[model samples]
Target chain A: EPLGLGRPATPEEVAVWDIDIRPDGLGLPEGSGDVATGDGIYTEKCSACHGVFGEGAGRWPVLAGGQGSLTDARPVKTVGSYWPYLSTVFDYVHRAMPFGDAQSLTDDEVYAITAYLLYLNDEVDDDFVLSSENFAEARLPNEDGFKPDDRMEVEFPAFSEEPCMTDCKPEVEITMRAAVLDVTPEETAAKEAAEKAEAETPEPAAEEAASEATTEEAPATEEAPATEEAAAPEEAPAEAPVEVAEAPAADPAMIKAGSKVFRKCKSCHQIGAKAKNRVGPVLNGIVDGPAGAVDGFRYSKAMEAAAEEGLVWSHDELSAFLADPKGYMKGTKMSFRGVRKEEDIEALIAYLRDASE
Target chain B: QDDPAIAIKPWMQELGDGVDVSPYGMPSPYEEDVKRRTVEWLTADPVSSINFTPIHALDGTITPNGICFERHHSGVAKVDPAEHRLMINGLVDRELVFTMEDLMRFPRENHVYFLECAANSGMEWRGSQLNGVQFTHGMIHNVQYTGIPLRLLLEEAGVQAEGKWLLAEGADAAGMSRSIPMEKALDDCLVAFKMNGEALRPEQGYPVRLVVPGWEGNMWVKWLRRLEVGDQPWHHREETSKYTDLLDDGTARRFTWEMDAKSVVTSPSPQAPITHGPGPTVLTGLAWSGRGTIPRVDVTIDGGITWHEARMSGPSTPKALHRFYYDFEWDGSPLLVQSRAHDSTGYVQPTKDQLREMRGLNSIYHNNGIQTWAVDADGKAENVEIS
Candidate 1:
């Protein structure tokens, strides 16, 4: 209003633009097309694609029935199930129906088709006159089903005018629980590993062979420590003398190989410098730390219960979990299928001992 | 005439294995840029609402099958084309059914047409929120459709004299359907089976979709399946709750189908900034009507201060796209560009303010007023309302 503008659009500008329609049924031209008239127009023009009585034909979409079944597995949402208004049917039909010959409908025919569509959806009874005059009073069934989303009200509050800092909240609570491991789909892992393996095999075949041989030796050495511990309990006197004599001579090659196998546990358990708690508890201190005891990470109910019963991540406890993650801790979200190979499990345990210590 | 034709690469060189690779085919390499346009922040949920079809990116006549705009109240139906069946009961003279094979038995015809949503550009009535023309005007598509006429199919069923309305239903889990009048059915309705001389793409109803030329896209139900004839109208939810327009007086408009004549300049608009320099600038746009073929389109460079008749190109099919061009010399001055269209019946496109005045601002559907594009001397276009 502040800036001076030219005069309003002229009558001629308005005359060329007479196709507008109002929802109150105002500006609706004088004419009527009822259910009966619409039926005739429909059978002759629409039934081929839409089907007779608004049930669609073939791969063509059906247009009628299944009302009041919105929550059902298969909602029969035609114009009846989901349409919010009757005027859309009439307006759309009048402008485009019979496919390819749009706007061919006269004002009266559109009204008649509108009336017929209502009759088919069972929204109107017989003798319903859907003319421009009485069009405004008609109400649809799902009128209350829709309401504008008020997310803006809640979302707007989240974005505050004040700058946020550390004191935004005194404490953060962990109400819901989640897993420690990032489980990947078989296909995704296979694809990633396949490409990497293919490239690695072609260029550095000898290096890969050497690593594989070292990996085999590392698992054997890892099991020697576990075997000695188990034998020590069985023969206390004899095992003490044997362990004291052979402990210094334990296989170092197996330990070196086992350390490389720690990558599998890296996502859930951590090791070395800057290794904090993750989905699972930190492995750096797990050799002596109580089971499921990580500073911030929440453990599964099974793991927590195990820790309450005096279970610790000893070599035996760790071996059973490494064999089968989900089986060892039921209800845990860790989806890992487990290490099937015996040697790989040994390698992983040896690697964990070297890293955890 | 500086007309340059790009070399058409054969299918072998372009698509690799061609039709054999896919039981269904795809768009050519030349049309790689044409695709369904979308906005990430437009709606909170992806399944609830999606914007599609770059109507501005397409040229000539047909909207290639791969890029047809799709909007489903429910998700797109994943129906097996083989198990597809159509039943016609209700008040018909005789209850009949047809399979996908049976539908092919009827004689078919081909025609080029455009399907546009009534809500296309409805968001821009108050103010333009979207930047690209694809998002603003992407809810429309033009295709050379192939189908059997509805009249022949009705004759096969032997419609009872009392049968007045035919309710068409889809086999989708949503059971998407709409009520169609008998008169419009016999007049010009076609049970379209193919688009652009190819089988209907799975996204555009696969086997068949009702082709209601010049009508709102909703009535042209995709994945069609059943038909019930009745003597009364069906007040389906789509008709009453969704598509109806509400006026300022709190009363709602009903049964107002048929897209009024409308036109919009596609290229050199905001989404498509004018790249070529000033000399002999070719300004192109599209015009159409549900009423009939678009007769003429007037382009105004100085914001409707003056107008010039644009040259109509290609075949002027009813309810189909008509490309219009206005060649002019540009002096690199700021220009407020707009296009106005007239149908065969002399109906002209209205301005934004005039439409808002008459309809009273509350209506969400059926806004076919003239669209204005403000172009700077730098050739950047912006959607503007002309007072």
Candidate 2:
């Protein structure tokens, strides 16, 4: 007996959108997945940004480790160390995983990924199988680390007390200043890198000469020193950072076709000289470079791990990556849907090679 | 008598542009700088980020819809009103869906409330970090919303007796959702469609949004598409993983909903420096509380050496921004300036030390501590912490 304004929703429609799973395992679907299966799915879908071991790349979420570091300064809150419930892991992965391509995973895929994450966190054995029936059995280590908000009982009484007025303190001295620390979020790492690059090459005349040479010949020599200087701080000591490969003579038709296809990436990415990082990292010299190699540009955890695990952007690798970024690199920050046509991919690669040179 | 220069001015002699010049009105060219600005590195990208309201340049309580601070989890969704449908499901007796036209049939109410993000001054939990009031306390806006009372909608749907929690879900790309206790939903919640006498802005959830007055901004799910009644709270990603307050003891506090009383001196701050030579200075600020109305606000110019009650102005409505002003003759001396707000619940804005002592330093949300600004003799201001 309600206001008859709209029709009753069909069960099928509700089932499609009613996707949230709860802590008590209320909405879990009938599906099963094991650690081995999860590992394969995770490697194909998630490892590009989350890493092989669930160690987050760049500023994406860290999913493993940090078991007992909550009380320490700069605690790493991850799935193993911080998440209060295992259901949250399954629910989050099912609902919002792969960053941009959310809700695209099958229930079995979600279960497998969740199990793999559990294995990465060391909560599950390698042979452990996770299903709707046994999902409740997997409990998070930090299950007891949360409490209902106690602000009213613990904080309100003390904070509500009448404050002192008139000569509250004898003499006030400036204890700290924001300008001194200068840790404002507006002060970006890219700006610092640019400044450092400028400081290192103080001779303005040399910079002008290099720019002229780059424009005339698009020489690797002109760009190498600049990118190398910026990469010095982030590069590991043991491994030598790979330099961009010299481009072969450009195919004019292929480059033209690639330039047309590059429009899809131009919204989030920039290229050529004077291109700065935008929503996505600058694509200059990215064709043959290692994954997650851009200086001052934060990459997803999976991308960082892939780079750490020796992921070089060769032609076949780039083709596969561009074909299905999420499917190939899981958890990557890149949101672009793959170029469907094979020709578009080849043309894009050719354009990038020519443009980088 | 008119001055000779003004009488012979070009604008005075010639006709100005007609209405045909602009199909839609815009802010004057001189007011171009008065805009929402974001701290670029605050988030991964602009799409899933927040922008600060230009509180430094604004006066009065009502914030214009154009310049209100925007927070988006998956960017602004362009939802067509014709295609939008609000569904009420779960524990309700009848699962109902309403079109925009069907929703307009219900009796509506107009209420002015200040929607503040829980992390408005979250950065200043350690100390005075952001140099400007806009950056420190700009994640808030007071707007007159026109909508139907949530209680009416829930009653129309006929909520089952067992339902204690309602999960409000948005239609945006993130599908932002939050669990609300039935008590709060019945009290002051609104399924709003219009703001400031016009259809909601696309950035502000154009078709419809849930307006949980006085609660955190995230709870006001934009492009609100569904409400699911349940027996218990849904510890979703936003609730458990993101919004929860982590403490130093390795424990976190969850569902800490209500925002405490807070205030800040807007003018004569870093961005809105005192350009004129020091004479009669009017120190004005905004104070609000989620619990109730701000009954009083105390201003301290000598770093709490002396406190004076500022004069409260306009309607002192519950859960709305209350403007206060303190006029005084300036002595042209360097001084530490601060404002402390006290709500009707007898809650005074605590100092940074007191808040840190209670909740610890790890929390990234709910830092409603008293803000301090140091003004130099040159009429310039800087963010500083006093000992």
Candidate 3:
């Protein structure tokens, strides 16, 4: 007899959570949707992050294209080119999709999205409908590409040998240097630049003030002003105090609403005292500041040109920019679709003003 | 000036803050920098993102619970242990469910194992891409776990003869799930409830998690809610779309579960570069294997020109991290340092070129290649690749 510890899980309880679809077409819900339906759903639900036509937005996973690119120098391993099974597409979309919102799509929507993704990859026609019955028939182009683990047979034999000792190579030459490549984080670069600047020039008064300002201000604000002047052969310490004093006042409710709206931007931009630069520049004091003025942050050419044109991030300018970042500044590197709601933008501006300061 | 040794220091002269000050103790404020960090650009959102353990800043085998590397498909589930239930059904003679209290009744065992994400060193596949060890090889942690063997629980339910696979699912929003072979489920798999002698941290599945020792971290479903006995593999999104390793020829490799033998020199690496002028230095590292135990580890100083067997110390348990060290007098000359781990299965860690030759550069997971660190004359170490 069993210990009878827990009661039996009800069928309905199991059905709701048993959402996995296997490679052999098991666990798929009964539903049908065509590529046309999927196209609309993908645009409405996915395109904000996963670009139109499955090309991917920013660092989001690409859902289609890149057929036969697995062997390329920079292989784009999208669904059609890399994934081995069609069921995987259905499974992934059903389980985790739309970035933050997961498992929100219906069975028909998942089916349609899967069908549309196939069409985007050129694996199916626009009229092709995908359902539980015909799901396995729509095989991926790389269906036979996958095999079971064979590292023991293929890799272990060679690597298992005792590694060499003494004279493995004749003369080791430094082919590539990390410093020359300069892929290290901005903080390391700034620290090295500051050290070099201190070593070269013994300007105690200015450098002392810069260092003091760094410890006093937000850490993210430390790098740009101190190292920018330090890297260059000039002592421009006057701007540091002014930028530090640029904190803006805001109402609590507006800032609160803006914080909620800022969730959309949180994926790329980080703000606050401990915020470090991520995919986007730290949104510390962008409000009422010069365009593209965040220190050590590489801005798009369009933004640099806008800054050259004497554009400042005034409330109106920020509202315009937040409304349409790319539309306002053509060639802007920001991949986000601007905030559609006016209230959200206003709240975001208030939040950026209050929170960053 | 008077000697500080003779002069009474503030701590010696006065009583310190009482133990009740913290109630629950924390690491000293001075050790604030010892934290898990993430490369922000790696994933779409922080909820589904992974953070790296600060292996460079840590010593010894067990990683502190606070600083353990966290990987969440749907963020950490705040599971109330009292409300949590572990249900065992599907292909079972008698389906059973266990509350947290009921689960505690099962005889538990304590074991130490290293949970490594298959994608731990996946970033460095192209060529010494990430400069820091934290980014390159920090998606792993070793912790002592207290749990009931999954086989014991399965036996309690009495799995039917046809049952060949067990689907482990989480209570997270993503409902992360994976199919474990029946043999593995009955072998060493554990339904762990506690880690490092304390309740499992919320990020590490609070109430319960499946600890599939030596397998990829994803298979260890956190906030584990259910176990379904089945006849076939689920081939779910995680197994089919994500965890599967795509090779150069476009073919992908599935069920690449066992984490191969791998090692990395922790100290004198990018983040923990040598600050003191070269003299007597102890080069230490961590090595582990999913297939079995690590028998030995070798440290190379001159880019394989010389290899010294590192002295294995601390717990050398199977599937657990084995700390290794090589004491050497540093002469301040430029050197290319590397470590090679030899596991119990007579398998040695493969080089990047060898891995590329076999699996190709298209893979985003299961990269157990030997890492190289170029130490310049100034004692700064940089990630580098050698032909």
Candidate 4:
């Protein structure tokens, strides 16, 4: 079959990707799931992100105990203090897990959630059961704690010699400092809600490419969510756009409230007609269009100097930049914090003109 | 200052936009802060998270396939390379699948390498928390891939001498999988489907992936759907629960897969700080090595007292990414910097107390230490750890 270039793969295409399991039990499938039927199918599909005792629920993945915390100081590593293979806990809960519902379980619900994650890490006994003929009597307490990789016999002979070039260190000291434990990522709450919509009125913010040298200024006692995004619009649906100019851009309840304000602009804009550009642009005809038109969208330099001072988006400049996109774009990298109910910016420009028709 | 190129601005009195204005072109909204960022509380979202790779705003050693670093798990699967396929199957001998025009009829090749991320600089193995070189050594990138040679598709579906592991599997939604062996999938694995020469992006795995050259970017995998083969090694959840390693008397390491000789610096770093001050700077960085090329690096602007040798620049290839530089002249004091690398098998890189006196502070996957920064004489910087 040398260079035969792809063809055979039958047996129902190798039983749909031969699932994968290894560690001495070699793909153990036939069935049998216990530990009280994996605590009732892990409380109906992994207790909303693995918690009802696999005690994890927040940043997911914890699947029980950290037994003798592998040199603790915050070492949790889980799957009963760092898995060495219960066939990678029933092949990662039968391939990929319950997070966004992957491979939907069931090889006896991944052997009853790997026998209830080995009875929540006490290595079994919630009335065991597990099958594939006693999967070689389970095994995992760090199955001889691995070994393999020796970093070329302990770190390539202490970092292979010939290094020192002049005095080679006698005093330098620092110890540590990410801004003295300041933990990087700041973007100052979207630059203090675009500096409170530039003090509420002479607007233009949508993060006008954030920089008044913003090296962190976020704690103005975190002004209660930028004072409710500069006083949350106080009801002025401004005469509901005169009954939305006689409704009918397929007004399915204003395109279902512009498809629920397009889940906050589909996490960085994208519209219909197979909308492309993300992190903003691709409105498919960016409402009342013109300014920095979207062909391969790379706008902002104050939106290409307001599209070279011509601009457009009319309808009252697209309802004053959807009621305050950084007070109306004074340098928009658009971190969105606008459209505060001017009737959901007239139902998101009537769902972006009924999704660009 | 007033001559600014004798002011003929507006891009020489404008008329731009029309080379079919973007049939597919991007970057240059002033390189929008050269993206690929993340650390939104590290991970619990953005679909099995991981982002990093601005590499303090890139330069030289490839990377830019729109700022490299991604590491999905269940996200960017977009697929549809004409409904992708691949397959292969356990202990093969005759079980294939292919498509994507049967792997564009084999015989391709290319190479370049450097995938990294056996947790690249894993949060400085418990010390100097992330401060940029795009979060302490942005996961890692280096590109130029192309494809085929997984020993010409395991010699076109015929392996079996008790296989000896392979696994792979990806088609996303966290179907990640890993295993690998079989003599590193017949040495230098590939299957790629282009990279630095386009085709393959939907978050870097559009039509295919799985490179593994010098191993470990979670064994390359990407949207790569299935491979199988076997006779051991699966222990999946990315190799016995997350790329093993763990050392310091609790034991772990397991298939550690190369990637050692590190380096970093990237412009007075901490988001390229020294915005040109204190005379003739230059500096730069990157170096690499999954066990090859990076012939040498060593910088140090006065932290380890005085070292130098840098200037490596572009293509040194073997398991890719090299770049280097050094220039220097700055006298504005307060420096520190660092670098290190080496590797054309002479290894040398270590430090962070020689990897915490041999793997201890909870071996959060490989680390590659020797980083440092400090800078400050107003040329900013920070992320320290010196010794």
On DockQ, the candidate that comes out on top is 4
Model 3's CAPRI class? incorrect
Stronger candidate by TM-score (2 vs 4): 2
Every prediction's TM-score for the first chain? 0.40, 0.55, 0.53, 0.29
* Cα lDDT tens digits for candidate 4, B1-387: 587778778988988897968888887798777888777655556777787888887788888787888878678888788888988887877878888898887888887887888877776676776678787678888888898878779878889899988888888777888878888888888888889887878887788888988667888887788888888777778777777777778888888887777888889887888876799889888888887888889888888888888889778978788898989789988898888988888888878887888887767777888888988898988888877
Fnat value of model 3: 0.48
Q: Could you report the DockQ of all the candidates, in the order they appear? A: 0.02, 0.24, 0.21, 0.25
TM-score of each: 0.52, 0.78, 0.76, 0.31
Ten contiguous residues minimizing lDDT sum, candidate 1 chain A:
A176-185
Give the per-residue lDDT digits (tens) of candidate 4, residues A59-147. Answer: 65656666777775445677888787787778777777776677788798888878877876767655678988887788888788888
Model 4 chain A: weakest 10-residue lDDT segment is A218-227
Runs of candidate 1 with Cα error greater than 4 angstroms are: A1-357, B1-31, B42-44
Candidate 2 lDDT over residue span B1-387, tens digit each:
877775567876799998869886789999987888886535546777788998988888999999999998778989989999998889988888889999999889999999999888876766666678888899999999999999988988889999999999888778788999999999999999999989899999989999998888989999999899999888887787777788989998889888888998998787788777778998889999999999999998898889999999888999999999999888889878899999999988998888888878767788888888898998899888888
Q: Write the per-residue lDDT of candidate 1 for residues B1-387, one digit (tens) a residue.
A: 654454455843674665577665566778766677555433323433456677667677667677777776545667777887666565554456577877886778988888898777765544433455676677788998889888777776668888887777665444556768888878888888798887887767878788887878878888887666767656554556556655544445666568877888887676677767576787888888887998788887776666788899999978888999998998887776778887876667776665666655545576776676667778887666554
Kindly report which residue pairs in candidate 3 clash with one another.
Answer: A6-B97, A145-B251, A166-B305
What is the alpha-carbon lDDT of model 1 when measured against the actual structure? 0.63
Question: Could you give candidate 2's per-residue lDDT for residues A1-357 as a string of tens digits?
Answer: 356776687787678767777889878899999977898888888877665566555334567766887786545677888888888778778776776677888999999999988877768766678998999888989888899988888988998888888878889988867555343443346668876988898678756664443232211110011222223233322111113334566567777788788878764577776666654788878888888998977676778889999999999999999999989987675646699999999989988876675
**Models ranked on DockQ:** 4, 2, 3, 1
Q: Could you give the candidate ranking by lDDT, starting with the highest?
A: 2, 3, 4, 1
Q: Go through the candidates in order and give each one's C-alpha lDDT.
A: 0.63, 0.81, 0.80, 0.75
